[model samples]
Structures are given as C-alpha cells and as structure tokens.
Target: MYRIPFDRVNWTTSSFLIGTALIALFGLPVYLYHYGANWFLVALFFFYLIATMMSITVGYHRLFSHLAFKAKLPVRVFTLIFGACAFENACLDWASDHRRHHKHVDHDGDPYDISKGFMWAHIGWLMFKLNPEPPMDNVNDLRKDKWVMWQYRYVHWIGLVVGLIIPSALGYAWNAYHGLDPWIGALGGFLIPGIARIVVAQHCTFFINSLCHTVGRQPYSTSHSARDSAVMAFLTFGEGYHNYHHEFQHDYRNGVKAWQWDPSKWTIWTLSKLGLADSLRRVPDSKILLAEMREARRKAELHLEEIRQQQQPGQCQRASDKVHELVEKLAANYHELENAIAERVQLSREALNRWQNETRGIMREISRIQLLTPA
Candidate 1:
C-alpha cells in the first residue's frame, strides 16, 4: 500500500481537487432536486464541457505539447482562456509534464507513471508533491510565446473569472431576462456548469493517464503501458487512442483511422480549413503500417516458438512447415515493403500503390496465420 507523505502534501491542489469533486458528487443532486435542471443550465454544462475539454485535448495536448499543428492567435487565445478554465494548469506546465511523461513513460522521471499505481497516475501525483519539483527548462519554446507566459502568470485568476464567474453571470442574466428569480439560476450555474463541469473535465483528462494505461489494447506498441480504448476515446475527446499516441507522438491525429471518433482531430482539421490552424503533422501511412506489421510479426514468431515447445520433434510436421512458410514469407515481404516505403519518395505513384497493396496482403496473411496456431 502507498503511504501519503503528509509532510509534502500540496494543500491547495489537494483541497481544490477534493473540494470540487465532493461538491459535484453531493451538491449537484441536491441542486437538481430543489431547483431542477432547466435548458439554460443543461446548455451551460455542455458548453463548458466542450470548450474546456477541447482546450485540453486539442489545444494543450496536441497543439502545445506535441506541436502537432500551429494555430492562429485567436485560436491560441481561446484555448488558453478555456484551457485555464479546465484548471489543469498553464499550457507550458501541462505540456512540459506531458512531454516528460512521453519521454520517460513507465519510468522514474514520468510524472504520472502508471507503474507507480492507477491512483497515482489519476490524481495522487497532483495531491502529493514530489520532493523535487520538475524543472521548467523543457518549455523554453513555450516561454518565448508571450501569450503562454501571460497565462502562466495568472492561470488561477483566469480560471475563476472565465470558468466560474462567467457561467454564473450568464445564468443569472438569462433568468433575469426571462423574468424568473435570477438568484436560483446563478446558484445553479455556479454549482453545475462551473464546479461540476470542472470535475468532469478534470477526471476525463485524468482517465487518459490512469484508465487508458490500465484497461485497453496496446495494438500499436507494447513498449509502454499506453493502450487504445474506444470507450475512453468517447470520454476524452479521442485521446483514448493512447497506444497510437505513444508510438506516433507528433502526429496530430490520435484516432488515425478514417472511422475513429476523434473530435479533436476533426476540430483541428476544421480549424485548418477556416485558416485558423496549419502545418498539421501526420505519420506516413507506410510507417504506421510498418509498426503494425512488425508487432504482428513479433507475436507470430512467439506463437511459432510456443508451438515448437509444446509438441515433440517432428510432431505436427505439417503445421510446423506451414508456420515456417508463413513466417519466412512475412519477413521477406516486410523487408521489401520497408525498402519500398523508404524509397517511396523516388518511386512513381503506381509503384508505391503496388507495394502498399502487397503490404496489405501480408497483413491479412498474418491475421490468418494467427488462427492456424493452437489456442
């Protein structure tokens, strides 16, 4: 069991996290029971939810942390404002920690290393301060941006004003305009959209650190604890594709598939169309396919070895021969495919297409080979 280092407790952070969560848990139901939810309150909750959640996923994680894309000033300012409202921290700090997490995943230097424990990755890291605070040297590029520096200087105040005050103000004003008791709306706003929304957004982001690492499939890479979860993607605005993100950190799209539900990716694409974002980085499909094929090949080799170990020499000779045949072919095709992708820049379009098709065929063969192996 992990022991709390009371001496090193981050009182402010702990208080805020615990306080907001308690209120959201108990206070929200009570408020609903008394005043009941109105369309204005529901709209307010969703509005804050989308704005703040997108700010963290699209703005903080992708744009700022990975430099996946560049955005215009208005976009930057808007994210900074609402991102502050999410109350995670300034972009520089959040990005610095995130970069470090990727660099030192599941290791000593990772801030929220899941290897430490699920709770630690989720929120314990924040409530209990590390003896030595992480240095800020990693974010020199962000420091050069005046807007980021400005937000860093006053993140708490910005959050209070925009995240809480504005929502309450809007609720009160709307009720007043409708000739209702404005105080009720103001209270509802502060509790539901203001406080409750913060808790929801925060936990969703935290889920990326905890649940994403814990309960998902690592299809892209098993080098780290990161995994992909469609459920988490829905909750985290598409950040649930953790394995892909870890393997291809600089790619702007987390859910790389055409049918994947990555609202953050879509939002960035939309911003680019509106001329608000540009220079979106993407991993080459060939490279992504290569990663998948390599992992599959590794698994197949293990399965072959396991089969050999389970059976006596010359037993199941046909199965052994078939496995050897598939494995050899896969390796040869993998080598040729690697060369093709590496020389893709020099290859004509038709030639590249042929190589891609060959790679896809090898992928299908790998899948079928898995079924041939004994359960």
Candidate 2:
C-alpha cells in the first residue's frame, strides 16, 4: 500500500471544503427545485453545458495548455472570461497542473491519480496544497501573454463578479420589467444558472481525471491507466478519449472521428472557419495510425506469448502466425484508409465536398468492421 506522507497533509485547504459545501448546498437544492425538467430550461442547460465544456476543452486544454490552436484576440478573451465561470481555476494554473499531470501520469507526481481513489482524483487533489505555491515552471509559455496573465491574476474575482453578480443583476432587471418577484428571478437565474452551473461544470471537467482513467478502454497505449469512454467524452466535450490523448497529447482534436461527441473539436473548427482561430495543430494521420498499429501488434504479440507459454511448440507457432496475419491485414486496411483521406484532401472544393460524404460513409463502415475485430 502507498503510505501517506506527513508532508502530504498540507495539501488540504479550506477553499476546497468551502467550495464543496457551497456546491452541495446551493447546487443540489436549486437543481432539485428547478431541475430544468421542462423543455425550455432543458434546452438552456444544454446550451450552457456545451459552451462551458468547450471553454475547458478548446480554450483551457487545447489552446492554453497544448497550444494546439491559435485564437483571435477577441475569441481568446471571450473564452478566458467564460471559462472562468466554469470555476475550474485560472487558465495558467489549470494548464500548468494539466501539463504536469500529462508529464507524470500514473506516477507519484501526477496531481490526480485515480489509483489513489475515485474521490481523491475527482476533487481531493484540488483541495490540498500539492505544491506550496502555484506551479510556475510548467507555465512559462502562458506568462508571455498579457491577457492570460491578467486572467490568471483576477480570475476568481472576475468569476464572482461577472458569472454571479452580473447574472443576478440581469435577473433583477428582468423581474422588474416583468413585474415579478425579483427574488425568484435571482434564485432562478443567478443561483441556478451561475453557482449550480459552476458546481456541475467543475465536476464534469474533473471526471476526465477520475472516471476517464479508471473506467474506459485502453486501445492505443497500455503504458498508462488512461482509457476511453464514450459516456465520459460526452460529458467532457470529447476529453474521455484518454488513451488517444495520452498517446498523442499535441493533437487539437481529442475525439478525432466526426461522429464522436466532441463539442470542443467542433468549436475550434468553427472558430477556425470564421477566422477567429488559426494554426490549429493536429498529429499527422500517418503517425497516429502507426501508433495504433504498433500498439495492436504489441497486444497481439503479448497474447501470443501467453499462449505459447501454455501450449505445445507447434501450437505456439500457429498462434503466432495468426497474430501476424491479423496485424498485416489491419495495417493494410489502415493504409488504404489513410491514402483515401489524402486523396480526398487534394480534391477541388466541389469535388471534395462531394467526396467527403462518400468518404465519411466508407470510413464509418471501416470503423465498424475494425471495432468488430478483436483488439
């Protein structure tokens, strides 16, 4: 068992306790009361959820942490401001810790390791003072930007004022105009949408650390505990593809497939098209496929080895041959898909548009076939 060090006790903080209490007290009550059970509130919540999730995935994770894409000044600023409303933390702090987490995943240094426990990974790490001071070494890239620095400096205050106060004020104004009870509007708008949103949003973002690591499939790399879960990805704006992310951290899109529910990737793509973002980086398809192929081969070889240890020499050889045959077939299929994608990329706009639909259908069929095959 891993022993808890005495120094680790310093990790706990009152902010964590207070934050948890506030979330439970305010969020649960409002959520139970309004619960957005109706179509209107449900629609509103969905929009809020998408916006907030994108702020974390696209803005904080991809933009600030990995520098996977560049956003226009206004877009960057807007994301930063709205992201603060998620109540995760300043972009610099969150990004720094995230970089560190990727650098030291599943090790002693990883800020949130699910092996420690589900709750610890979800929120306990945030409650403690893991480091006496905010991590500065991992955040040099963020320090160069003045806007980032400003947000980092006053994010908490900004969240309270803009996320909470502004909403409450607006609620009051609406109530006054409509001749309704301002308190009801304040509770519905500010308390429900503002504080409750923060609580839920924070947990959804944190789930990637806890649930993603513990309860998903590791198809890409088994070196770490990170895994992929479609359900978690939906909650986290496509961040639940933890295995692929651990394998290829620099890719702007987490859920690379079009059908994957990655609002973060969609948001960045939309922004890029509208000239609000640029320099969107992605891992080359060749490299990604190569990694996947290598991992699959490794897994097949391991299974073959296990069988060899248990079976006769002749049987072992036959199993090994089967594994090799499967690897070769899969590799060839992947290469064909890659070439098709490349060809599509070279087509004219009209031709490309026409080919994309057909290509997507073919790709979907290929994925279905691949999924049916044993990993």
Candidate 3:
C-alpha cells in the first residue's frame, strides 16, 4: 500500500487546538481539585458523567450507528441532541467513521487501526486532516434524513454551545438568582461536569479503539485485535466487549449473556419493552456457541501439533487423548444446543410474522367498520 506523505497533511486545526488546550488546562485542574481536593464536586461530576456516557452508548452506538434497534422519533431525536453533548462528533459522522473502521479493520484504511500505533489509533489520527473533503461515501445514507444532516452540519457548534457555553450561562443565572457565588457553580457545572466530562468521555470511547484492541481475552476469535474486557465495559457503558462487537456488529447487544455487564444493552432492552424502541437485533445463541466451539477446537489442534513436533511420545499421546475427549464432549454439546436454538429461532420468527399480520388485519377491519358506519 502507498503511504501518504506526512508533509502533505495539515496537522492543525483551531478548534482542535482550543479544545485540547481547555481540557488540559481548565478541565484537568478542575477534575483533580474537585475529585481529590473537594468531595461534593466529585459526586456531581460522576452523576453527569454517567448520564452523558449513556447518551453515547445507547444513543450513538447501538441506535444511530448500527441501527441495531428502532427508536420512536421523539426518543431518537432526544438521543441525537444529548449525544452531541458528549462533544465526540455528530451521530452521522461518528457512525460513518465506525462503519468504515469495521469495513476496513486491521487494514491501512481503518481509521483507528491499532496496528498503526496505540496513540495514533486512540486519538492521534484526529489531529491530521481527514480527506478535507466531506465523507460523502460513509454518510450518504444519512444525508437523505434531514434531521441527521442538520445534526451533522452543526454538531460541533451545538456541542460547544449547549455542552459548554449554555451550562456556564446557567451557572451565572443561578448565582444571580440565588445570591450564591457563581464561581462554585461555574467550576462545578461548566468546568468539572461539562468540559471535564468531554475529556473523560472522549478518552473512554477512544480506549475501545486502542486499549481494547491491545489487551483482554480473545476467546471468540484471534483473527482480529478486538478483545473482551470487563473493565473497559464498565468505563464505557458496555462497549468493552470489543471482540463480540467486531464479530457480530449487527447485533444490538454486545454482552450476550444475561449476567454480562452491559448497561447500554439493558437500557435499550428496557426502552424496547416500553415501545420506545423496536426491532432489537441479536445473534442466535447457536451461532455464538458454534463460534466459541470452533475457536476452542483450533487452539486444541495447535497444542497437539506442538506436542507432536516436540517428539515427546508419552506427552503427545496423553495430550492427544485429552484433546479427543474434550472435542467429543464439546461437539456433542454444540450439536444439542444448536438443534434446540435453531428450532427456537425459527419458531420465534414465524410467531412474530404471524403477530404482525394479525395486528394489521385487525387495524384494517376497524377502519372498514368505521367507514361502513358513515360520519
């Protein structure tokens, strides 16, 4: 692959510099002082942090980007507006970059490929000009939607105004109205929760593109750098299961298991039940189990090959026997599970289709009855 000349790239932007400087100077000091030097600020900061993080996870990632689930227009609009507060980017832009990353993962074209280097993958790439021309290909689908286009066009300004400026103004108003010192609210609301939250939120999201690919367990597939890290999930509101996400990008849920720590998935699921969202995508259990089985078998085969190459006859024999036993047990379990899951998925799909047809019929009948009665 041909490399773009570094000298040809424009490496600085006024907005990026201002944003970086504010975070480093004002945001960092406020966070350290409040979190360590003041307890009350810490509590306030954390509360806002959690809420904003969910806006990105539940709103940006699962809902907007992947369309893994369908949300009501009102709910969808709310998410898009608040999601901008994270100051990451517009949902359309963010989603476009993500889709491109998945499409060209591990290749030079992948926007955040860890193979490029940890820093580069995490946030360095943003420092350089990204094709200067608009990303028409990645976001063509979004352009047709006026709301998404509007957000994409003005996300940066909206984020700055609402996420930063408005909060500061509100802080001043409260101080004037209540006769409390405005500095306290300004520092607490604007600096600590607002600016500081952006820094932390951005890093937490970036870590999935960097740290997640660099560390954690790869029980599912070793073909990619993605990994499943519980710690990362906790920090990023359930985005830590990178391996599963990369493997099943279309699935709405990252942590497939009931016990998995995926607050984002839980939020979406609860909202779906309340009719705020619908069409939650999920990978079949059979497919996930089969993938796991295949990986395990691959590992066992490699281990056996190593033992055989070492010329340790007894060890090889014992290892071979163990592998054979394990494989047989796993195969039996896989087949049983697969058969049951396949049947369940088929039945579920049929039931859902029938329900949709019946509901439509009932609605049509009601309309006909009203027409026959005359106004």
Worst 10 residues of 1 by lDDT: 366-375
Collision pairs in model 3: none
Per-model TM-score, in order, reads 0.93, 0.79, 0.79
lDDT of 3 at 173: 62
Could you give candidate 2's per-residue lDDT for residues 212-275 as a string of tens digits? 9998887678999999889989888789988888888988888876687777888889999999
Give the alpha carbon lDDT tens digit for every residue of 188-282 in model 3: 56776677767787788888899889888776798899999899888778999999999998899988777779999998899988989999999
Clashes of 2: 3
Instruction: Give all candidates' CA lDDT scores.
Output: 0.88, 0.72, 0.72
In terms of TM-score, the best-performing candidate is 1
- Model 1, 137-180: lDDT tens digits are 78889998999999999999999999999999988998899999
Name the candidate, 1 or 2, with the larger lDDT value: 1
Q: Which portions of model 3 show Cα errors greater than 4 Å?
A: 1-44, 130-135, 313-316, 328-375
Best-fitting candidate, scored by lDDT: 1
lDDT against true structure, model 3: 0.72
lDDT for 217 in candidate 3 is: 79
Candidate rank order under lDDT:
1, 2, 3
